[model samples]
Target: MPTDVDLGHHGDRDVAPGLVDLAVNVRAGAPPSWLLARLTGALGRLAAYPDQSSARAAVAARHGRPAGSVLLTAGAAEGFVLLARTLRPRRAVVVHPQFTEPEAALRAAGHEVERVVLAPPFRVGPGLVPEDADLVVVGNPTNPTSVLHPASTLSALCRPGRVVVVDEAFMDAVPGEAESLAGRSDLPGLVVVRSLTKTWGLAGLRVGYLLADPALVARLQQAQPLWPLSAPALVAVEACSAPSAVEESATWARGIVAHREHLAEALAGVPGVDVVPDARGPFLLLRTPVDVRSALRDVGFAVRRGDTFPGLGPEWARVAVRDPDTSDAFVRALRGALGQPAPAGDGGRPVGSVALVGGGPGDPALLTVRGLQLLAAADVVVADRLGPTTVLDGLAPGVKVVDASKTPGGRTVPQEETNARLVSLAREGKRVVRLKGGDPYVFARGWEELAACRAAGVPVEVVPGVTSALGAPAAADVPVTHRELAQEFVVVSGHVPPGDPRSTVDWDALARLNGTLVLLMAVDRLPAISAALVAGGRGGDTPVAVVQQGTLEGQRVLRTTLAAAGDDCARAGVRPPAVVVVGAVAGLVAG
Candidate 1:
């Protein structure tokens, strides 16, 4: 398919036609040596009927459930298909901001499927679920943006006749197995779906299972194809439960949690991206200023967009948590896409071009190559209060330096008035440079100024700055991109400006965006922020970073998030001129 064509979730990650994928959230690592050996050994036996006996026993022992309770299927995808046929619910409800396959499967079964869009940041509240749903399908540590719901929350929906299916496909990636509701027989009508593909990299083997009462298991088993699970899949099930494999999985899980936090922090630092916190799974959801679809491909990267999922709009994307090298590469490409900026007042009439640039966080070093280029070319400069003076000092001795900056409640010119002066000066034909801290497009009000210039017939161009979220991690010596951690990043405002309805903020999408979250001026509402993230289904103990005076000396970086970030900042005596970045990325400071 063409790059512009809608290839769905699988479309963006194709590096070469049908190869090199980063789209699916499976673990980056290859199958274990033991599993490989088992598959090869099993290959000889495939000519005959498969061995369900040992495979079922191995999985049952691993999950600590009876063999009868573990009904193996070809893959997790098949689990959804089987359920759609077995239960055949008249009206099915699928929770949003997660995977689409289950919903699609349900719809395909000729079932009238209703979608329950998760609340912002992505949580299933009481109001969203339909009153009379006979079957409800949901993914835990969901796909796209991996949001893990608590088992307690899952228990609430369990009823005698209603089929409460929780997909624990990503649970193995989380730190503790205690969080999963799988194999719990006490909950009537509880059907848990699990995938070996994600944790063990077994997609080719096509092995997945269903967890429910024996009767319900029998129901789904009846719907399976003859010899549904392959001989290799049976061997994989046995190998997956080996003591060595179990221990190795635990180690990988720990790393995934740590890496997820690190990636979140890195994304939080990038300007024009919003990464929500408490995402415990191995992937994240990012909301980007650049149309990530085109921009990601242009930059030698690919990711899943939110538009395809119910409830998530077009601007959002789902990314896997990759190693440090890939994340950095993605960030660099993202910077390129957002490089298009227009200076507030000056349409660089005859004066050498005036480009407004965001320096990003506190580290001037993180400034994009383009930002540095424009600065070197400027004959005259105007700067904001937060941007470091040292950055201006680096300018040529012959270049004229002007401070057209502002402080809160200043008698100095308002942003609107200051822009007027810039356009007037630029009209005189002098090389004018207006430098701001962070990417200018973000809450910097660069757009408002652009609108003003357009009205005045002034031409303007913008230079991309490395925002504090990305820079804070970089300056703190943390690599936001860790191959073992995050694959996606999201950046959003800390708080909306005055007169805007969302100036207050909505915790749903921000919370549901399962990645790192970077906030600008978000300190005031820390409690609400934490609650929102928690409500959006983020974990409470996720790492956070508060970077004050980023990229500049006296830079104070306090680490905390959501509920506790405000108190931590207060104790550390951190104040404005600070950017708040919350997520696993904070933990990525190099050892």
Candidate 2:
């Protein structure tokens, strides 16, 4: 650790004027537009003294508790200071690698603070703290490490005389608030402080609240001034605590899970970067070998230094989760900072190069090296739902991910719109990658994207992938072409029924062929296609194989005869995105 470290140093200090900021845990985008409007409306109330009652009731109701049990603070940090000023503890223990405000507050108030630093993975337990300590403060889904402690673990810290304070400032970003203790009123001497700063982008307004028994709330209240929160801050708190706002917060939390996963995987891919595996917070903790924070700043990124946290050293850093584009950009900068190979395109500055990159099947490792390189180098990626999503997780955080997935029976973006988006992005001098599953040319619409880019004067290149037509069959151990049973093979789409006007497949010609037949997207129309083959003189007992979600963890394979393929598929509840093979060779492999 550095000797010149400031114990009070925070993420805000790491941020500069124009960097891709991954330092502060504050939400990336602005507060909800409606929230801002509410605050704007409250501006008229400025003439009045601060009224804390309504906001207090709203917070209480949101937590399913009485109004008396809640105490609104300017922020959770202020609540820590109030606790320090009011509570007189003989032995105070502050958990390390957590938010420093509580411990800093206690120390400033002349209390001797004992540090309880948990090891890596940083989960809290009852045995780690001294039984004699009368005061204990810990952060749930703690800072820097982003580990969410179980509610039972926190509850175990409570004793008759000991007051356990849980900082749940980031709990709102956890889906379902699963490990939160904020709503638990049965625990003895437990105080939960929550902040709206992270989820609602309200750091500047400083709105937060404390939940505890009425008696403790009164004691903490005594240490505060009368007009602790301004009028607008009060309105902000009440407005955000409403039912609609709570639901929106949950949605945001769910989105954070995806963003965090995307950022974590990218960071993990970089050499010398070690990401904590159990991150549930909206930020990630990374440890690198060579002071990547300073190096990152040189590459236009500002990351929070972790040395100030008692249990962390200089090699560690904390980064906030951002939307995909910002995340991709940060990951690219990080790779550059770490001295990794420069991404493709001139001098790593992506120009008008459009890469029709194959995402392979469902597996990330199946992606060709060049395809992965192009992905990392791309400024924009228009992705399909069935593409190698695992590869997306490994992309640079700054890459723009445009979901052009055409989900069946669900809303889908038009192909023309996706084409226009790719061309427009390329026109803006971005390196755009039209990422698709399997081989981009094999039933994945690669040529359409290629033609669009070519017409738009964008330099486009295609990186072929391992097509699932063969990959899925091979994964299921079914050979599309066998030495003795089948001499040739054919692949066709079964997305449309046999008699549909859009259907071009020659079922009779396919049936007469003495070889294997591989059908893609054939699950829904399997029954119709199988009957067509049988009626076209294909033997009823010809073997059939259905492989669903092939090459993935939940993959399933079913074996039957061509005559019963449809019934068997229906009986087994087979779904789309499956491959069906019919021929004598289909029986060669065990399902």
Candidate 3:
């Protein structure tokens, strides 16, 4: 797992080998010690096509189900593809913030995909669907933001002709296996897909399975080619069916849940963050004032961005929880970036327009080229203490620097007044820097300011900066895009629930992705974030880290898994100027 350009590992370069991949959920080592013993016995016959009936029966016995209920797949992603292809429901309503492959497949098959939204804090709305859609699909312990809905809620969505396909690729990490719908038999039109890639580190082998009614399974099976599963993959199935293997997996599940809680608590202690509360899954949601993605990258870490989901945008990201050491290392790298200096202040022009600029965390060095140009053109600097103070130095000696920074303990001006000031300045012909940290597009309240400026007939332009979610993780030397780890990245906020109009982050769609997540402004929400991830079905022990003052001096890192996230942040004393990363990239710190 050492840095290798040949494999396109995170942080790898053509000139220099880089990264011992952690973002990839697969294990660094080959077959586990116990599993190795099974290779000789069950895998010796690689000369011929695998016996499909026996291999499937092995899987059925382990789940205590009939063979008719199971259908082997070439990884769970294909199950969704198959279901999407085979099920010709009148309408396809997919839960937002879940995996997109299903929807994509449905679209390719000429079905209309309707989205159910889960915005911030990743909670579902009061009425999910019209109850009229015939084919519906979702994932438990949803991806990206890691918000897991309860099984009862998922069961309620199941009805005749309404194929509720649940992706449980991560369900093995949950200890109370009883909560999963896959083990149940009564629900009709219920199809469940699971992957051995994440649970047993067999992604390359490409082995997965589906469980549903015999009729549904038969229809799906007919669409796939014969010998859909490779010989080695079938061997893996036979090996995983052992009782001992299941018990060992159980132990790992318990550990993940415990670690997720611990990690969440550690993040909560950090200031200026809103960690999603009640995170029961392995990964938690995070919210910060800065652009989390750029912040992590600038500090030497890489994380997934949450912008692609139906309801989610570019302000969020996802990380994997690995072991303890890498998690801690990630935090230290972030603290350095957060404390990086901002551009210095200069004189004002008093011209008649405004440019709302994002600072991209506190680091002036990490600012986008356009942001720098806008900073130099600013006639007035209206900024808060949270933005890097050094950015003021970028201005001319006598630029009008309006200290909008609020008192730590005294009465502060209302946010409404601040908006009014920007509008007034622009109307008076002054080029203003409505300088907020991170990208103005992400959680900078730019939407409101733009609305206000337009409504007032004041000319306005927005200059975007690197979001801190990416910047902070970069400073920590983590790479979100290891070709082997994942195909997509998601960015999101960690503050309020996705369904809440007041929230800036997309909670629902993030809960459904097969990508990575990066969070911002999530210090206090660590506990809730942790619980949401666990409940969403991300492993409780997924690696997570909080970086305080990334890309600058005084960088402090708190490393832990999702279960222990809360406590670890507390122990490390991480404060407001931190970016939280939850994914396999966090584990790269040690590499």
TM-score for each candidate, following the candidate numbering: 0.56, 0.60, 0.54
Q: Give candidate 3 misplaced runs (Cα > 4 Å).
A: 1-29, 40-43, 340-591
lDDT of 2 by residue, 1-591 (tens): 123446789999998854556889999767989998898788788899988888988998999999989999998999999999999999999898898888888988999888899888788777899999999999988997899998888899987899999999999999999989888888989999999988999899999999999999998888899999999899989999999999999999999999899888777667778898889999998888778887777655788999888888888999889876567667777777778875453264543878888777687878899998888788888889885887777778877788999998998989879878887788688888888989989998777777565444456788999999999889889999978999999999988889764468889999899999999988888889989998999999999999998888878999999989999999999887789999988899463
The global Cα lDDT (0 to 1) of model 2 is 0.86
Candidate 2 TM-score to native: 0.60
lDDT ranking from best candidate downward:
2, 1, 3
- Candidate number achieving the greatest TM-score relative to the actual structure: 2
Give the alpha carbon lDDT tens digit for every residue of 1-591 in model 3.
112111111211111112223234443346676665555455557678777887799889987789998999998878878887777788778777766677777776787777787667776643777768887777777765566678888888877767788888777777866458878789978888888777676766788999988877888889988989876777778678777778877887787777667656555555555666665445555665565656555433454445555566555444555544344334434444456322222123343777778877677777777777877887788887655668897697767887666543566666668778987887578788877777777766777666555434456778777777777777777655667765677766666743333465544455555566777767667777777776777777777878888777777677788888877787777667678777766666552
Error of 2 at 434 (Å): 24
The positional error of residue 183 in candidate 3, measured at the CA in angstroms, is 1.5
Local distance difference test scores for all models? 0.71, 0.86, 0.68
Measured on C-alpha atoms, candidate 1 has an lDDT of: 0.71
Q: Provide the lDDT at 446 for model 3.
A: 75
Candidate 1's TM-score: 0.56
lDDT of 2 at 414: 90
Give the worst 10-residue stretch by lDDT in candidate 1. 1-10
Q: How much is 293 displaced in model 1, in angstroms?
A: 1.9
Candidate 3 whole-model C-alpha lDDT, 0 to 1:
0.68
Which ranges in model 2 have alpha carbons more than 4 Å from their true place? 1-5, 342-591
